[model samples]
Target: MATVSMSVNGKLVSRDIDPRTLLVDFLREHLRLTGTHVGCDTTQCGCCTVHVDGKAMKSCTLLAIGLEGAQITTIEGLAKGQELHPMQAAFREHHGLQCGFCTPGMIMAAVDMVNRKGNHLDDQTIREELEGNICRCTGYHNIVKAIHSGAEAMGAAK
Candidate 1:
């Protein structure tokens, strides 16, 4: 086991974990942050996405030890107090999800995309960037709408 120290959801956390434990498992099983989901065994599914030092990352692709000294943000940390993050609210208002299994990671990825690209995201650009994620339902129409609406809401708030 390796002792790793990192910040999670704005809280400092240090724990002992097997070096092989994936960051997703560490967050869910250890920290009880179950919002992060794993929809595919392979990393192709964006369902396991998280923010590492403000950048989007597939949590399943990185080992817990590999995240040492990094600041990680999961879906649970995206809001402040009782307020919903614009992305989350937009998804809710736009009906962006179906089964909802992929919502958390999708929102995280969308937020990361907008944070990096802003409201100027074109449909093709959004589709290209979101290729890493797969949604079995909604045919991606609502997803794209949600991203755009979320971007608009975020822009308006700023």
Candidate 2:
């Protein structure tokens, strides 16, 4: 077993885990942060997306041991008590979700996109950035709209 320490959702946490434990499992099974879903164990699906050091990354592609002191943020971390993050709010307003299975990861990835690409995201840019994340329910029209609006809100917030 390997001891891992990191800051998750602004809290410092440590755990003794197997060396091969995926970051998604560590967040879900170990820390009980089940907001990060596991749709495809492989990286094809972005359901396990999370923010590692302020960047969007597939938790399934990373090992908990490798993230040592990284700062991790899941969907649960995006809000302040009852106040939703701008991206999350936008998704809800735009009806970007249907089954809700992929909402958390979609929100996480959207926030990261805004962070990296600035807040004024065009539809084309949003679509391109969301290539990794997939939504089986919504046809991505609403998702794109949400991301575009969310990006603006995020920029305004900043």
Candidate 3:
């Protein structure tokens, strides 16, 4: 077993895990942060998206041992107590989800997009950025609207 230490959701955690453990498995199985789903373990789907050092990443594509000391943020980390993150609220208000399997990854990716590209995201940009995250249920119309509105709300909040 290899020992790895990282800050997850603002909390420092260290675990002794197998050298090949994926970040998604580490978060879900070890830490019980089930908010990060495992839709496609091969990274073809963005269902395992999370924030690694403030950037959106496919958790399933990363090994937990390689991320020692990194700051990781899963979907569970996006909220403040009872309050939802702007993207999450926007997803809800805009009806951006159906089966809800992809919502967490979508929200995480959206937040990272706004952080990197600034809050004024155009529909084209949003659509392009979201190419990695797949939501088969909603057909992406409402999802695009949510990200746009959420980006605006995020800008306003700032």
Candidate 4:
């Protein structure tokens, strides 16, 4: 087992895991951070998306040991002082979810999009950027609206 240390959900975490263990498995199984879902064994599903060093990344596509010392943020990290992040609030406000299985990843991706795109965002661009995130329940209409409105809300705070 390899010892890896990283910051998760604003907490410093260290664990001994297999070198080949995927970040998703480490988070879900070892760290008990089940907020990051596993939709497909393949990396195509954005359900395993998380923030590594403030950038959105697919946890399934990454090795746990490779992110040593990195600051990681999962859906559980989005809330601060019992307040939901703007993206999460937008998701709830816009009804961006249905079954809720994809909500975590969708929120993470939308947060990344808002942070990256800022106030200069468009519907088409948002849609194009969210291609990797698949939400089978909501038909994406509400998701796009959430992202657009979420971006505006976060930008306003900035």
Which 10-residue window in model 3 sums to the lowest lDDT? 38-47
Give the lDDT ranking, best first: 3, 2, 1, 4
User: Candidate 1: how large is its RMSD?
Assistant: 0.9
RMSD after CA superposition, every candidate:
0.9, 0.7, 0.7, 1.0
What are the Cα lDDT values of the candidates? 0.91, 0.94, 0.95, 0.90
TM-scores for all candidates? 0.97, 0.98, 0.98, 0.96
The residue pairs found clashing in candidate 2 are none
Winner of 1 and 3 under TM-score: 3
How far out, in Å, is residue 113 in model 4?
A: 1.1
Model 4: lowest-lDDT 10 consecutive positions: 112-121
